[model samples]
Target chain A: MAITVRIPTPLRTLTGGADEVHAEGATVGAIIEQLEANHPGIKERICDDKGNVRRFVNVFLNDEDIRFLDGLQSPVKDGDTLSVVPAIAGG
Target chain B: MSGETPPWVKGALRIEAAVLRQVEADALACYPSEACGFLFGPADDPPLLDEMRREDNEADKYHRLDPETFPRTSKMYFKINELRAVRALEEGAASGRPLKVIYHSHCDAGAYFSQEDAATFASGGTLMWPCAFLVVSVIDGEVRDRKLHVHVPGTNGFRESPLTVIE
Candidate 1:
């Protein structure tokens, strides 16, 4: 499945300044892998060394948390939008 | 009005790298000591990590310490404010988000809330007796650790609990 993923500005360096990226995958993990394959270093920012999502970040699928869903294995159909928003700690 | 929890925070505690980065940057600007402040929630949403709003830090002249030795502490305290408690309640209602938590920083200490923090929470003059509190500790301009605490209304005062951010 091809889906559109939105990346925040802070991680834009890893994505070469691209605000949005497209990847093909069946699960969230696969989509992440595709993102990493296309843009090296992107995965490290989103995933930890053990391949788990970092606590400092949250992945929302259409405004709903992925954790309440299937987590990284959550399935994405075509045309779905995935928003990766890191919690903003700035005052 | 609290005993344990209402199950909402069972899986709602966590921060983001972007948030951490900003917090660290702000804390670094006042390095060599702690940078304390408050985090407000979104105008419409539930109390969660995503809803934090940083308020002004306490004032320096009020620091009760020698100003010459702790300049950062003085200037930093100058930035603190006694936030309008009603703003948090009204915003929570208008935005559907509640007073998620209060956040501060520690210069060289671990990211843990001190006894004074507990006393403040138990005071119950703010939004609620039970609320979330977060602390970020920086050393040499680097964030060494972070901690979150949840205060609950208790028999005499508010009870404190530790919050863990799970990956």
Candidate 2:
């Protein structure tokens, strides 16, 4: 399945300044693996050593948070858009 | 950097007096905890603030869900609820007024970008959005100070932006 992933500004460097990229995968985890193949060091930024999505990082499928869905295993079809959002906190 | 306006303060942000007052009031109302929200406006040379929308800090909600991992209370940090942000983005786009600023308040600290704040929003020299960040300092339930910071793009930091309040 072909999916489009919207890259946030913080991770644009990994994608060579491109704001979005296309990857092939049936699940979000597979798509992330595809992203890692295309852009080195991206998976580490999005996922931890245990392969779990970082607590501060959110993955969304078509504007719906993946955490509320099936997480990394969330299914993706052709033309689906995924967004990688970083959680920010300060006071 | 706290009170004295810097020489580079060339009026990068223009906001309405009523909106500014609302921000300060909201910050004070939240008190000991931080208040977070979005500023919607045009994507012009110097963005003009048209409206403001307050969002519930997700940190408080998540803390209620899993306190061990989300240890920090609302008093120390704020994570804008993702759902609210998405909805705001959609609605703003529909209205032709995109999000121009992300505003947050500090309980007792001065209106300045903390190290944690910079790292959280602009890690590895990349900012989440091409918008400015406004920090309001609320001390003892009073708005003590406010500052605007814009990402320096290539640099992993933000520079002070002059905020002009219009009546």
Candidate 3:
């Protein structure tokens, strides 16, 4: 399934400065893998060494965070927009 | 309760006196807990900030869910929900009033950007956002002072930006 992914500013370099890009996948994890294939050095920024989403990298499917769903195992369909945003937090 | 205003800091961040007051009010309301929000306005040499979009400090929820991941509580930190943030960014772009400033209050601390703050905005020496950061100092349920921080060039650090409050 082709999905549109919204890219944040910091990761724009990998996407040729495009704010959004399209990829093919049936799950969030597969989509991320597709993103890495399309844009090298992106998965490392979004996921940790354990292949888990980075705590500082916030990923959402539409208005809902994917973490709240099934995480990497989350199912996906057409017209789903995945947004990868930088976590806004500090002490 | 610190920070000196200088004509330095890229350019002044202009805000209506009333809107700024509302930000202080939110900071006061959160008091012991740090308050967080976004300042929406047109980007200009003197960015005119007119709206304040307050956010719920989601630190506590995250901290409770996984202390190993999110260790800081609301008392010491502020976390803006990313889903809401994506929506805000999208809406701001459509409305022509982009989020120019991400503001947060420091409970009983000075209005200086802490190390963690620097780490958040500039992880791996890469700046996350193109906007600025405003840190407010709230001590004893009262606002003492505030400061603006922008990414320092060629480094993973931020420098103070001038904040001009107008009436």
Q: How close is candidate 3 to the true structure, as a TM-score?
A: 0.90
Please report, as a residue range, the 10-residue window in candidate 1 chain A with the lowest summed lDDT. A82-91
lDDT of each: 0.57, 0.79, 0.83
Off by over 4 Å in 3: B1-11, B43-46
Tens-digit per-residue lDDT, B121-141, candidate 2: 776656655457899999888
User: How much is the lDDT of residue A27 in candidate 3?
Assistant: 97
What is the Cα-based lDDT of residue A34 in candidate 3? 92
TM-score (all chains, Cα) for each model: 0.47, 0.80, 0.90
Report how far off residue B55 is in candidate 2 (Å): 1.4
| The 10-residue segment with the lowest total lDDT in model 2 chain B | B1-10
Give lDDT tens digits, candidate 1, residues A1-91: 9999977555666778777889889988899999999989888877879887653455767656575588899999898877675531211
Candidate with the greatest TM-score versus the true structure: 3
Residue-level lDDT of model 2, residues A11-41, one tens digit each, is 7779998878999999999999999999999
Task: State residue A85's C-alpha deviation in candidate 2, in Å.
Answer: 1.7
Give the clashing pairs for model 3. Answer: none
- For candidate 2, the TM-score is 0.80
What are the runs in model 1 whose C-alpha is more than 4 Å off?
A1-91, B1-12, B40-47, B64-80, B123-130, B155-167
Separate DockQ for every predicted complex: 0.01, 0.46, 0.54
What's the true lDDT of residue A51 in model 2? 91
lDDT of 2 at B20: 91
